[model samples]
Target: MKDIEQYLRQNKPETPDEGQFIIETNARLSNVEGIKGTVDAERHRGRLMLVIALVAGLVIGCLFTLFVVFFPVPSIETELSAFSKAIVSLKEWEALLLVPVAACAIALGVFLMNRKKEVL
Candidate 1:
């Protein structure tokens, strides 16, 4: 264990603000009440932008997935139609119905989540 630790210490990539980084990054973050404080406002703005970007990317990804599933592109329509027909033809009635039911369930779930947030 000691040897492994020493190897890691010697070979690890050094970061800027090494000691401060070690202390701040390793410390348990806690909200200290009654300490009205201000630091670099730009950091908070950058954090907000990062969050927005992540959320936007997630939303766009989901939208793209749904769009592909629901709206087949013209180039792929023949292939998609054949696949869709195969599914309907091969599966039992109950099994074939599951696709639409699953889509409805997902829509309902998203709707309910949005409704709850609106109420809150």
Candidate 2:
């Protein structure tokens, strides 16, 4: 073991010149920085798109709710058709149904936003 160690020490490997080593290191660092910037930009774009979509959904939902409340269907049961009855039932339970759906959507969005991404 001592002989082998002595031989290895005596035959130490040669390193590249300082200038070439520095150039290669700088090239590698620049590549890494480019990748970092790209990843950051993509994350920013994704978050912006998510916010826009959320705002659009909320605006449309509020507008639809307003339209429903402002132009309610007539509640005359004497000549109620199947479609009209269905519409009435939907209108009556709209809040109950929409509340859970909206809650789930918000929860999903929050979970997605808070979750960590795994890299392969």
Q: Across residues 1-120, which tens digit of lDDT does each residue of candidate 1 receive?
A: 999999999999966667676566545343222222223343454455556555655665565445445644344345656667435433424444455556555655655554454344
Task: Please give the lDDT score at residue 3 for candidate 1.
Answer: 100
Question: In each prediction, how many residue pairs overlap at the backbone (N, C-alpha, C within less than 3 A)?
Answer: 0, 0
TM-score of 2: 0.54
TM-score of each: 0.31, 0.54
Residue pairs in collision within model 1: none
Q: What's model 1's overall lDDT?
A: 0.52
Q: Residues 59-101, candidate 2: write the lDDT tens digits.
A: 7567666665565566655578767855785677687557646
The best candidate by lDDT is 2
- Model 2 segments more than 4 A misplaced: 77-86, 89-120
Candidate 1 regions exceeding 4 Å error are 1-39, 74-120
